[model samples]
Target: MIAANVSSSHGEKPRKPPVKVLSSQLREGKGSAVGGGKPEVSIRRLGSRRPGSSGSLAVSVVWMQGTVLEAHTDQNSALLLDETGNFHITGVKNIPRGKPCLSPGKYVMVMGVIQSHSPEPVLRAVKMADLSHNAAMHRKMWKYEVEDLQQTLPS
Candidate 1:
């Protein structure tokens, strides 16, 4: 059975694992968060991709946390404010029901891919969670964790 299974699999192509990346290293196309590499990044660096540049970073998945500056439920989008800058988040309509609300002043964590980087960077959220219950604590911890990861990276 083992020999047969191995022979059958040999004809199929192996799938490439998704590349993990940090926001700062997105352009450089570095490692992922689970691998002890820089995972999260500031909003300002999310739009670093230059037009016409080709790489996995162009569509690299990212995890970002910020406060909602404004929400347009009718439009299914929101304005997210982070320490570095503001980011446009779309696909709010896709968030699962009973999750946290996307109101102004609410802290949220968004996991998504970069949809575009034209006039501004837009993040098409695949998942979202409200962090307002303990926003301060979460923000501080995230800051420290990112700093530590940055230090471990090669200078």
Candidate 2:
């Protein structure tokens, strides 16, 4: 099984590095969204996987960046708006110690797995980092980086 730990804490089990993907690539089934290497997939793609397929039971770790549209601290969830669409993220309180707080209008980076795809795509966050300090620059840079990776990386 592919472990999906993003933390560097010692004594923990080994984990796979997350694949960075764009919300659009995830939604449209375009770009480098397949292969024998890392699992690059969207919520729809993940939901389509049948049992017994390769990595079917493995963790599908992904890294994404978006802006917080709304935060429901009481429910430990929030609405994240990426470039193409909005994603419902849960387990807000799971962020590691010293991470920035999640709040509306704040740009943040989320590392998580797709939890569901029925009503909508939901990301079960394991870690989150506030990037509001350099939102504009960071967003642009992230866009270019993802695009470049999608083109160069094998599917």
| Top-TM-score structure, candidate number | 2
* Whole-model lDDT per candidate: 0.56, 0.64
Show the colliding residue pairs in model 1: 20-32
Q: What would the TM-scores of all predictions be? A: 0.58, 0.66
Quote the positional error of residue 12 for candidate 1 in Å.
13
Model 2 TM-score on a 0 to 1 scale:
0.66
For 1-155, candidate 2 gives per-residue lDDT tens digits of: 23344555697655556666656545554222234443444322222334444322222567789988888877989888888787778888777741355778899998887655334457788888888999999888886665444333322
- lDDT of residue 17 for candidate 1: 23
Q: What C-alpha lDDT does candidate 1 achieve relative to the native structure? A: 0.56
Best by lDDT: 2
